[model samples]
Target: MLWVEKYRPKKLEDVVISKKLLDDILKWAREWDSHRKPLLLAGPPGTGKTSLALALASSLGWGTVELNASDQRSWPVISRIVGEGVFNETLSDEGEFLSSLEGKRKVIILDEVDNLHKKEDAGGEGALLKIIRKKPLQPMILIANDLFALSRDLRNHCKVVNFRRVDYRSIVKVLQRICKLEGIRAEKDALVLIAKNSAGDLRAAINDLQAAAEGKKKLTVEDVATTIRTQQTDIFKVIQKVFKSFDPEVYSMAMLLDETPDNIIWWVSENLPLEYEGDDLLKASLV
Candidate 1:
């Protein structure tokens, strides 16, 4: 199994989110039966949105039915799969025999909901809105990278919870724990750099660490740096250099580092504000 899945948090407390937010989610789960609004978890990629949903369901002894972008999520598919999963109990005969599973509920997780606007998903948004308005028998969680991408009607039907990007130090701590578990000797600085380069993406950091530490017991800064340089140039770093230095040599260095000019341009364009002030941002944008 992939390390990400193997190390996934199995309970709400195990997930690395703010204490207040965690408590709020727990409360939301507890009060879900009484309340009707579906929960919408909006955040950047790799911020544990999906994990939180799954973990909460697992902790509450609820079965989960997840639908992602890979699935055919049209009106028919949503109505059939999600509609049935919401209304019908998921307890099997064996499951029922093993545990006193009366009044058990299933959690419906709609992942990557921002992608529901695709041509194949035509009328899916309307169907989803209808479902949310009607308040199904089960609780629902919608995960999206951008809440604004969802329809206003759909947004109004749900309670929005914003997830901020995780801190790099927290990510590094998780990486160090993973290293200890895997019996790999990883330098702290190397792990820190991986955490930094991941740009709050814990999944990316873990994947990078795994790629760099593969077949090696000891991981060093050089190993991580070489792996990153060989795989893909860090767009965040490139953007920082472009905005901060604004030096012609930075572009040349990016080229030497195997980054395409077009990618660098886009990265710089998209992230100019991170390294630039008000006037500086406008000036950099003109470039």
Candidate 2:
């Protein structure tokens, strides 16, 4: 639990490799108008969607209200949180007479908005569509794992920005920072292994590193070998074995290969023209 959220980035600059998008988001914040359209952040998990939203709110010195996809995302919630009600709210200063610096513009972050499946009964998507189409009193941002899953109305109304998988080097730097914070000495090889296994997910890599580092002050390749696991790349090997073998059970061998059917099909498609000709090519195609 301690390491789970400890390593999370608190600002855009700390988010490893999202400089361009961060710049664009900040620019939009600076150029805020009454009609500023909602911004949609689309990406896979562990890529700092929540972190970026919070960081942006902080940067602008604005009050932030967050809601996840599972919450009541209907028009009522949106209106109460960011619509006319927010604009009408005011707070009195304490007896100290300290002046408040709170800005009128608030940042409302909606997480996993893609999970708000279209409901014919509730018209949840309809409400969101109208909100996005019309200008809001406060700036709103939507976070979703899959942008394609969003409704056409919501998709077109908002400015979409994609968050891609973290690269190997960036993941490494993040892991190193965690190691330093935790006072754990981890080998470069171990860090690289965790990063590679994470497949470009910094959160997953950090979790794996923390899990592997448990009960030890030092982390090594042996620790990673015993703790962290990765999807096998044995599919290619199995394919090669089937191609080289003359056994009548070649079909069975193909089946035994570590590849998923999708991968097997891709491998066959990739090298068919280069390696097979005539009837053999036709047979491969049929396979």
Who wins the TM-score comparison?
1
- Which 10-residue window in model 1 sums to the lowest lDDT? 91-100
lDDT of 1 by residue, 1-287 (tens): 67788898887777889998988888888887688678999988778999999999998988876767335534455566555544555534232211225656767788878767533243457667766776766678999988888888788888888998889999999999999999999999999999998778787788888889999999999999998886654656655676666577776667764333434565667666677789877887786
Among residues 3 or more apart in sequence or in different chains, the pairs in candidate 1 whose N, CA or C atoms overlap within 3 Å are: none
List candidate 2 segments past 4 Å from native: 72-79, 83-104, 120-123, 229-287
TM-score of 2: 0.71
TM-score, structure 1 vs. true: 0.76
What clash count goes with each model? Answer: 0, 0
Q: What TM-score do all the candidates reach, one by one?
A: 0.76, 0.71
What digit string (tens of lDDT, one per residue) describes model 2 on residues 190-228? Answer: 999989877677777887787789888999998987764
Give the residue spans of candidate 1 off by over 4 A.
73-75, 85-103, 118-123, 233-287
Q: In candidate 2, which residue pairs get closer than 3 Å at backbone N, Cα or C atoms, i.e. clash?
A: none
> What shift in Å separates residue 95 of candidate 1 from its native position after superposition?
14
